[model samples]
Target: MKVDWSPLKHELGEWRAAGLTLPLWWRDDDAVAPTESLARLESLSATSGVPVHMAVIPRDATRSLADDLSDQFIPVVHGWAHVNNQTEGKKAEFGMGRDAHAARLDLQQSMARMRDLFGARLAPMFVPPWNRFDAALLPTLAEFGIDALSTYLPRQTATPIAGVTQINTHIDPIFWRGTRGLVPPDDLVAQTVALLQARRTGMQDNAEPLGYLTHHLVHDADIWEFSQQFMQEMCDGPVRLYRHDTKGFS
Candidate 1:
């Protein structure tokens, strides 16, 4: 699983020469409680100096999790229940086949629960389960006090709605459809290079942070090791860290 990484290093070098910085961030989803894997993840983040946005499912989230979180972590809402209400398609908590009124109720309740559990620790961001959500629900996010939306792939628009911004992850190390192990490191590195190159050339939104996504609860040893190495390498390059307050880019 050794990756060449030369292409990415070279591209980063170009950015350094131009005095430009690559905005970088990390997000890990489906956290409801503390576990050994989460402890390891926190350790890795401490070592790499990259803060992790822990996407917590509100219905299952506990106050103990909020207490355990350090300054290096940001807790964001991960959907109402993480339940797949769809009958015959990709699993989704906020997708089609669900009644809009019911969905809004779920969201409202989730917001209340999360606020009670996490208090001021919660970031006003919503991450739909399975990276799938109904587009029709975008306008309603601000009504529930959500300020941002996160999903897979590059974001199509920075602000899907006036008050809510969108920022998405581009690189996921796990091969979910396969072994769910770390994807071939070489392939992952190549994809990272291409994604950065697109931004450098203005083919994509350069303002958006290059995001790395993970699911710590399911990480095998190989995935954990790969994540550590990949994150360390990214930090070694000309990368600027992104915080929730990062303006304009969301």
Candidate 2:
């Protein structure tokens, strides 16, 4: 029998129905300003009882914060350098913004740097800048050992890599482009609520976790303040959080 889905009830049904394993990642792109963002990530990891993911630039050729994650958070390479390539006809894409030749080169360099330093701790996932990447750059991910990519909604139809996994997001905490920083509490709540709704009513396509992306540099102070609370609310409400591997996506 098809289970009747509500908010928490629907999510719970999927968990058992599809044997779903939900993985929630905590993102803070561009490590330029590290103090407040890292602090909040650390606390959230400790309190959340789940592993939090940090995407670091490490272009400084340093691993200060990655070495000091306190075992609660996991570190992944955000990018070699968080530079802008919006002028290339897109506003937020990094490597994908480059031409085919340049994009592949950047991917190779990033993978080498990541493996040389982070090794096993390094995830084979790339979260592009601005949550934007061209579909054409998809194949380059596999060439660089990036077997998985976390992007925004409307995933690529043609899978780029032979055995790669695609984890794209639909919800974001901050109201970027509109308010930049200092996002209103109501907006953040609304965004989370939409994700919560998507989690139910069989809206989400698969058992993938309700993906939410964030940019610490652009996120408002109020976001850091309420992120944990919002997460708690979702967990208490209807969403079940698990790792990508748990859901067989990693």
Candidate 3:
């Protein structure tokens, strides 16, 4: 499906005319091992000049995967095992059904493993699998030395849990509930336009960087193409590439 990016393009043009810059970031979740998918993701990042915050599942992630990552990649922790314990509800690795203490321990272990593997390249951010987590776990993040938390939707508050700052992805190209392929291009573009409009009009926090989320392992060709095109177009406009060390709370 051909995407009509006119709405987003017009909004970006307005920002450009006003000399406004949108801090733009990309995140790709559920990475464990090195594969051709990861290589393709790196190639896309190199071409578009957008670095990906690669969310690595610590329990299954190997140090070998770290070798495939370039300086353009920032490794962030993505839950311990990426396992969903919720028996009857929506999937979540850190949901209320599980003991919070045990979950915290998992997080601590993951942090240590990630630090050992990625070292200074680790962003110290926690991205829960499936973007689902129990709110009771938020206060415990700072105690575990986690500096940032990433999830879905625009962040409701920048510092939602005092020391732990929140950054979230606003645009996701996948239609997980349906085709598991790319969402209709027109719908994605329109949603992106609406998100930007809300920020521009003070309906959303403009200070929050606009985030694009992907799963490199699951992307179809259409998803890959859209990602490259969308990111490149934004780069050509008034978007400023966001880096992990400089932009977020971490």
On lDDT, the leading prediction is 1
lDDT measured at residue 82 in model 2 versus the true structure, 0 to 100:
69
- TM-score of predicted structure 3: 0.95
**Cα RMSD to native, each candidate?**
1.8, 5.7, 1.9
| Per-residue alpha-carbon lDDT of candidate 1 for residues 1-250, written as tens digits (9 for 90 to 100) | 5767788788889888888788998999999988898899999999998889989998988778888988778888899889998988899999976888999999899899988987887888899999988888877789988998999999899999899988889999999999988898888989999998888888999788888999999999889988988998888888888866443222
Model 3, range 1-250, lDDT digits (tens) per residue?
A: 3667788889998887777778889999999899999999999999987889999999999778987788878999999999987877889999877887788888789988999888888897899999987878887788878988999999878997878888888899999999999999888988988888787777999777789999999999999999988987788777777767755422
Q: List runs of model 2 lying over 4 Å from the truth.
A: 1-23, 32-36, 86-88, 93-97, 154-160, 217-220, 244-250
Runs in model 3 lying further than 4 Å from the true structure: 246-250
In model 3, the worst 10-residue window by lDDT is 241-250
Tell me the TM-score of model 2: 0.77
Model 2 per-residue lDDT tens digits across residues 21-105: 4445454456533476667666775786555556666565466555555555455556557677666565654634466776667
Per-model TM against the reference: 0.95, 0.77, 0.95
Model 1 clashing residue pairs (backbone)? none
